[model samples]
Target: MIVSITGATGFIGRRLVQKLAEGDHEVRVLTRSKENAKLLFPVEKFPKITIAGEFEWKDCIQGSTAVVNLAGMPISTRWSSEVKKEIKDSRTRVTSKVVDLINGTSYDTRPSVLISATAIGYYGTSETKVFDERSPSGNDYLSEVCRVWEAKALGVDKDVRLALIRIGVVLGKEGGALAKMIPFFMMFAGGPLGSGNQWFSWIHLDDLVNLILEALKNPSYKGVINGTAPNPVKLTEMCEKLGEVTGRPSWLPVPDFALKAMLGEGATIVLDGQKVLPLKAQELGFSFKYPYVRDALKAIISL
Candidate 1:
């Protein structure tokens, strides 16, 4: 199968591309820098893969069996009005472009599956609620971003299988939120952010990549699916587990006020969270390698 992927250089996208290549599938990565993509995924190793710039999306997506749309700006920053517009435009505009391309293509020529990325932020921050794919969407800033992003992807023709993978806080050693937090924990300054009571719905990077693979192969696995582990942990418990995994102290906590001052509205990403479960993924027989926070933390921190 030939797979066309946007945001192919992102943290999750990189691993996903490698996995597809390892499975002996042809990959066309839609990137702004073909040179950089080649450096990361060498031609000798990933000979089946090719990298092309955004202007070449038509060529990159042509004859593809699957199109994984992961293009979007990183949301972890001070949310100035300008940054907010960038965030919204980054997701909505790219998705609209892909949907238009897919819609314009002939039914037989178009990709069969469109596996797009969304997030648990669609559910909003709620300590008491356990959200599944069927849960109603929240009206927060992140939620609005996810809502519009998924909306555009869903606009693809009915002939295509659309898998909206609502990702959670991905735990891995290489990149993502864990990479940013591990350094502080290793230095013994790590602790819970904000009140530490917020529920954290997270998944191991390995599990997430596997879930994507499953979506690609399963025709019936369409619609929304949470890319989270079965178990959700409180922020405080997560910090404690990370501390244990690294053999460091989890005593020093960052106050909510301090985080708000530093990150502005972006602090909500760390200070607030949701209790999300991969109900649909599990129902579709997708098992997670790391379902618990302790085991996930140990695996990531050990690396």
Candidate 2:
């Protein structure tokens, strides 16, 4: 399959490209800087992979079997007013551009599938309820961002198969929520945040990638699918598991007010939480290699 991807240098996109390349698929990446792309991907080894400048829409989408849109501003940064606009505009603009490109092009030039990225924040911050693909979006900042992002993505021509993966906190060794927590956890300084009662929907990086592959292969999979583990964990439980895996203690608690004061609205991603379930993915017969948080943390930490 010929796959074109935006944000190919990002954490998940980098890994997805590598995996697709290893599978002997033709992969084209849309990036801002070719030099950085080379530095990040080291294309010398993977000849099937090609990196090009940011979405010259038609140029990037032409002759591709699928287009995976992962381009967006990072949510981990402090949510300044400007940064918030950037976060919204980054996603919506890219998605709108892609849709326009596909619509403007001939049928032969357009991709068959459009796989877009979103976040589980679509379900909002819930304490105990488990949200699935059918769940209504919440009114929070992240949730609104996700709604707009997905809406733009789905605005592509009706002929194309559109699939949106509403992702959760991905646990990976190199980079992600896990990487940020490992050092503190290893030093026995990591603990639950706020009241530690909020639910955290998480997924292993491998599982997330595999789920994407599955979605690409299965024509029946469409709309929003939760890219998360079936077993959701509470904030306190996740912290305790990390401590257990690293042989540390998680007795300290970061106050919610302090986090909000420090990160602004961005803190809600950590302080407020959601219990998301990968119901559609599971029903499609996708199996998770790392279903439990403890085992996933152990594998990532060992790496």
Which predicted model would earn the best lDDT? 1
TM-score of each model, in listed order:
0.97, 0.96
Model 2 per-residue lDDT at 60 = 66
Tell me the spans in candidate 1 whose CA falls farther than 4 Å from its real position: none
Residues 1-303, model 2: lDDT tens digits: 999888888889989999999999999888778898888877688888888876454786888899999999889778988999999999999888878777777898789899999999888887867799999999988889999999999888899999999999998988877787778777767899889999889999999999888888899789888999989899999999999888889988878887888788788888889888888988888889999999888887788
Candidate 2 runs further than 4 Å off: 55-57
What number of clashing residue pairs does each candidate have, in the order they appear?
0, 0
Q: Which 10-residue window in model 1 sums to the lowest lDDT?
A: 54-63
Q: Candidate 1, residues 136-167: lDDT per residue as tens digits?
A: 99989999989988999989988989999999
Instruction: Give the number of the best model, judged by TM-score.
Output: 1
RMSD of 2: 1.3
Cα error, residue 254 of model 1, in Å, equals 1.2
lDDT of 1: 0.89
